[model samples]
Target: MESRNPVIRRYADFQKPGSVLGNNQGRYDGNVITSTPVDETTQTFPGRTPAKPGERVVTMDDVVMKSFAMLALLLVGAFVGWNAPGLAIIAAIAGLVLGLVNTFKKNVSPVLVVAYALLQGVFVGGISYIYQNLVVADGTNIVGNTIMCTMVAFGTMLFLFKSGIIKVDAKFTRMMMVAMVSYLVIAVISIIASFMGVGGGWGFYGVGGIGILLALFGVGLASFSLMLDFQSIRQAISMGLPEKESWRLAFGLTVTLVWLYLEMLRLFAILAGRRE
Candidate 1:
């Protein structure tokens, strides 16, 4: 998946031409990097040594930049859509288009990603607004609360990583991967059941234990996904990836955040329904 901070960084540095030395200038070896040769034969380094080895220079600049940009765009779209579901539908369609464009394009485009964010925002906000109108009064605030909770969880994970409270080793990754895939399978089955008119196996909002469990499960998967994303981004930086792929990294992060928020929203709805 194309996510926030990928484990692999694109090395734009590799695009730089290699060093070439001329035969006549072979003896002119100095501190300068001019194309001068040191001997009668020309010396050229088509392929060189390992790139930027042992560099642990991971910066949060890329994450902050892309995330903020996407958030801002999304807010605007969401606000508009919240007021009008029609607009939300359009935004959703546009978002789908932009998402495809971003994923399939050979080159990454920040504009497209930002556009996609806006569209998704509209759809989310509009849906929240509709939920408020359809459910009990002031139901829309539920979405707000869900958003806050999701943010808190995301920040918690980040802080844990930064503070070294979490161990992100291969074994841990393997466990998480297995859990995530299994969770996805369960989700797919639940969706199919729902389509077949099977109510969460629970009466009313309870939709049964399956519904409630899936809601909570989504939250956990999304939160764990964030850990994976941050780790990937950091490794990419150490590997010295190009800056242009910031959009790719940003796209990944956006996906996780969205998934996390949606899960929070669903979990909240479940809790709210139980109270009623």
Candidate 2:
């Protein structure tokens, strides 16, 4: 009966106090699936092993699934607030505060995490509503385009991480943050100039010839954010962290991915608007 409980089921290693499972030290035997652990195998005692070397024996799926579940709750929350108008704004503020709280906390709390997700949904859905109603795209394809671009950017990032194409280093993260801040500063200045009826250079809004430059810069920001997410995943895997962490991973990814998509959307909009 205890085995059926979600929390207890994950404590299998804990249940066995003196064995390798309890001590947290794996004893690799020659056979991969046998009751012993080998250099490249994880024992699935009393039956199977990881099966192959260099294979991902541990995945972030647990985190991803839980994260999506939070997101699902968020979307429902968004729908409720969307039809109600003022509620979304309230939710947005609450979401922002929760986001900061979650980011600073070392341990993940399902309640806060889920609450944050729902709050963030309001912000996203609100923006989607504005874009659909105000912007002109290929009819019903704007939302689809946004979603597609987001998924593609995310998938590309995941592929790069898996293929050893992008190495995550402390220096890399610092440089990326510097560049991102610079971009944000420039964007703010451009808006200020526009308000004054003065035109600045093309660096901020993809105006002049700097639009592509800004686009690449946005991509770099998203990529570095991915690196940080990967770092967290690595730590969780090594520490035998809880399976619920998968939700946190997904939340982090969704944040970065959504930011990347918006940047790309703006870049495209700038280019398309110019062409028109």
> Over the stretch 159-244, how does candidate 2's per-residue lDDT look in tens digits?
88778788655455455556656777777787776676543333355456665676767766765566566655654454343355
Per-residue lDDT of 1-276 in model 1, one digit per residue for the tens?
122222211211212234333343212112112233343222221222112323222245866797788888878877888888778777777777777677657666777887788889888888777655654353446887887898899899999888888866556566666676677677767667666666744222247676677778779878977877676566444333345555666776776787788778777766766666
TM-score of 2: 0.66
After superposing candidate 2 on the true structure, give the runs of residues whose Cα lies further than 4 Å from its correct spot.
1-59, 77-89, 137-140, 197-203
Q: How high is the CA lDDT of each candidate model?
A: 0.62, 0.55
TM-scores for all candidates: the values are: 0.73, 0.66
RMSD to native for every prediction?
Answer: 9.4, 10.6
Q: Count the backbone clashes (under 3 Å) in each candidate.
A: 13, 10
Instruction: Give the candidate number with the greatest lDDT.
Output: 1
The ten-residue window of minimal lDDT in model 1 covers 7-16
